[model samples]
Target: MLKNIVLLSILMLSSCSTDRKVSDKVSIMLDVPVSPIKTYFKEHFDFESFIAIETTDSFLVSDIKKIVRSDDNILLLSGNRSVFLIDAHSGKLKVCIDKCGNGPGESKRIIDIAFNEELGQILLYNDFYKLLVFDLKGDFLSEVKVGEMYENVTCRRGEVLFYNKLNGYSCYPYMLKIYNLKNKTWRTVGDDIKIDFPIRSRGLQMVNSKRVWFNAPLDYKLYCFEDDTPAAHYRLDISMAKLSDDLIKKSISDPQTFFNEVSMGKIVYSLNSLRETENFLIFHSNQT
Candidate 1:
């Protein structure tokens, strides 16, 4: 019930829109007015049933890298070294899969995670192109070998989509690739893209059990995959032309400076994550 309340509250706040422009196109356009954080938080603040995770002997969390909510449980990945499946309501530790070795279901460290709610399984991954599958209870199921090292991954229809976020520095040319488990085949989704994002993020945003949205740290338009192709989902009400070609080129060649410039408001800040309600979508931008 607490998880439900938190979720409801987040969705409720995410529906805020001080201003908007309606559209009848296939891709809906939402214009949200940027308001001050102090006013916004003061207006929507709630002190009921907030969640706080405690550090334990078995689990010492420097940062929660990823999180997925299912039923009354939460699957969390911490610092890409520990994975925990805990009770969402009581905050009790259910299972901590921290097996780091060279065994069959072991890795040097867990780098990423993807939840297939439809399949009811968890995929623990590493940067070396490996997958450690586990059930909801954290039992090791099997190990899978992927062709490329993926920075972000999400599953759909028994297929796992991989985004190679190497920023064109790697040997691989394509940015997005899909691997079908049933057929044991591989296919590229889009053209070669090499821009690297500065902020720490979850590359793909899962919307319900059907849609997934994607955008880089500086990308102008958020994209959704349709028929394995990325289609424009929303226009961020920001001008893409304000971003010069030199900056785009630097995003790949030199990411640190690009991150610095973007942080100092050298250009239009980019949106990172999205939360949706019935009518409006809320985004957390980098600087604003």
Candidate 2:
């Protein structure tokens, strides 16, 4: 069963405004149809047999929390503060990191994990507020202290991008905390705008191998960083439903009531998740 899965509709916008001076605002009107929920199951999915990984004393898995694929290895994070590297094809355990202590090369809590294929390294973010580095063979190399706590972390081009919220008026300028692995320093990116409410911001997203994209949770504008500065990309407009400032403020105060109202079709909720590709921008709405 797919839990908390959102069905998204992809929309491709025509024409690209590349002129540095041209306004980067594109309005799109969507006429979404309201339909009832339905379920369907097919019997034959290539008639494949399932191969289960046996749980033994050496390969004990207790509640697999997250799985990340890197080449031929499958990295599984467990709820018991352990990380296991398994072979993707043979379903065999390669190495497991289960050291849960304050000693060196150990972590009390694993917040997140990312793999760098180019460097052949595994980056682990832990509750100690540090980023631990290990090779593909599960050997600890080094660890770096991070400045702030982040909910999401991603690495690209030798730089680690951390996404988290800042305390202050919503008008603060930037939210991204970028740490340079080579220079051993940190910096911020994105534009300063009114943050009317305290909400989770979707931080840096990798557009390609080098570029990263960003967008505010409350705003309809999409931005991409060009040399560490945010440049306007596109804007979305919904014709069937509109969100007003009053509704947004209410959502900040009482999210449960706001979601209840959105479920009842009283207001069109804000865009939850936004994703983009070379040609199209995809997103889902709260309206069923």
Candidate 3:
């Protein structure tokens, strides 16, 4: 009788543990959508009448600051020295400073900024194998290097994927690199992808809670990826102009509740002026 009782207790405990794990995962998922901001922007920010904002004139002082837009925010990389985080919706500059391993005479020399949102971190690749990571606010985290030589870095929400090329004129398949944030390690994935091209433009952006989007410069269009396959494509209309810098700044400040109170299926347009800019533009979207 005691043996049977113990067996029942073990089964109950196992079931309870599984239930707890599932409950915890569901709770976290409920707390935040898989790609809340990205989905909203994709749905709402159509090409017709969008505004742009200048996050920083770092280029004004020098040619160091380059703005790279992620799924939810814009990153200003000052060479490899410092980084600035801009709010995607409002264009407000949140934080700015140097990142990891402080250097007194830093020249701001980062080759690329890749955001692994799932890991809540950013990857900075300096040289072929030299890489560093930091929080969103220029805080030091960790650093590592991989392979022999690679010119660029590409990243998604959970992985920093890279590729390198061979020496000389022969453009052959070299190596494809993958780094895991959970394990904090690097490994080779496949050798079929050539290293002739830099890995800057290739990335996967999460669309909605259950969908993902992919952009390839070679294709020059945005594609929705479902179940690891191409699902939908959005072609640009040439008549629509890009957003002005002023509008981009505003959108960056508060993206979460920025475009609410509008229909989610049809395109809409709006006009707004910025704090210190003259020109005005319209923002059109199917999501608000």
Candidate 4:
């Protein structure tokens, strides 16, 4: 009778255990400050629409060479011999004709532009293998000959991350990059950091302080780099991809309203933006 009772108790416990649900929770911490970003815009030229190159001469002072949108302001590198500081909102030109460095190779190509948000300066690399550093006000700080790497090197999130290509290899290991401004010498992230994807990614982004996200070209995966090392990552599942597609479609459909919404709320920088170009590099911060 005692054996029978014991067997019955064991069966009951097993049934109870089978009825319980198992849930796995992943805790992801965000390091970037989730605060409202106050944007100030000063237009370099008068364009009918905002946040885009205006076709009209009134807005097109020169060619739209390059533009970088940061937390504080927009750095405009135009065809004219200078750069401009535009307010993030209102599109007003806070400072104009702020010349630091000339266009590369007779105005053919402008290499890479890096914004040092902490230092309140923008570093511009030209085709002539020269690096020009300028304050937000457009004041020239210094210019140095940077060699071949200057043309290919790209920065993500200011000076936190830097990337360039390897000689003679355009395929696997076609990329060489580094992180943190304190170090100038570039070191490849890790060995066997293979990204099996289609299109080549542009650059890396500091997703908060601890995590760095890089797009796998032609693939939907976001490669995570932790502590300047390759890490485990995942592709954007269909649902997340759909959500992102919707957001982008909304922006293209109605940029004004979308920009307003982005300005009014906390703007999480898009990982897609970093993938828009082929020369995009990688970056990370220390917060996380």
Top model number, TM-score: 1
TM agreement with the true structure for every prediction: 0.73, 0.65, 0.44, 0.46
Superposed Cα deviation of residue 98, candidate 3 (Å)? 4.7
User: Who is ahead in TM-score, 2 or 4?
Assistant: 2
* Global CA lDDT computed for model 1: 0.61
Best by lDDT: 1
Q: Rank the candidates by TM-score, best first.
A: 1, 2, 4, 3
Q: Tens digits of per-residue lDDT for model 2 on 1-288?
A: 212211121122111112122133553444343443243113211222232444566567776655566657767778838988877666677888878987777999887777766677788888787888888789999998884565556677777776544444343323556777767777766533446555443323222223455555555555555555556666655553556676677777876766676566644444434454454455454443
Off by over 4 Å in 3: 1-45, 48-72, 78-82, 97-108, 166-174, 192-288
Winner on TM-score between 1 and 2 is: 1
- What are the runs in model 4 whose C-alpha is more than 4 Å off? 1-67, 77-83, 95-108, 144-146, 149-160, 164-176, 179-186, 192-212, 218-220, 236-288
CA lDDT of each prediction against the hidden true structure: 0.61, 0.58, 0.41, 0.42
Runs off by more than 4 Å, candidate 2? 1-67, 166-174, 192-211, 225-227, 239-241, 266-280, 284-288
Worst 10 contiguous positions by lDDT, candidate 4? 6-15
Clashes of each: 0, 2, 36, 19
Q: By the lDDT metric, which is better: model 1 or model 4?
A: 1
Candidate 3 global TM-score: 0.44
User: Lowest lDDT 10-mer window, candidate 2?
Assistant: 9-18
What root-mean-square deviation over C-alphas does model 4 reach? 22.3
Candidate 3 per-residue lDDT over residues 1-288, each given as its tens digit: 111100000010000111010011111111212233556535533342122334434411134434455555666666556666766665555666553443421223565566777766767766434667777766667777554554345565576655433344222232345566677766553224332222122222222112233332222233333332343244444222243444334343543322332223222222111011122112223323
Tell me the lDDT of model 2 at 7.
16
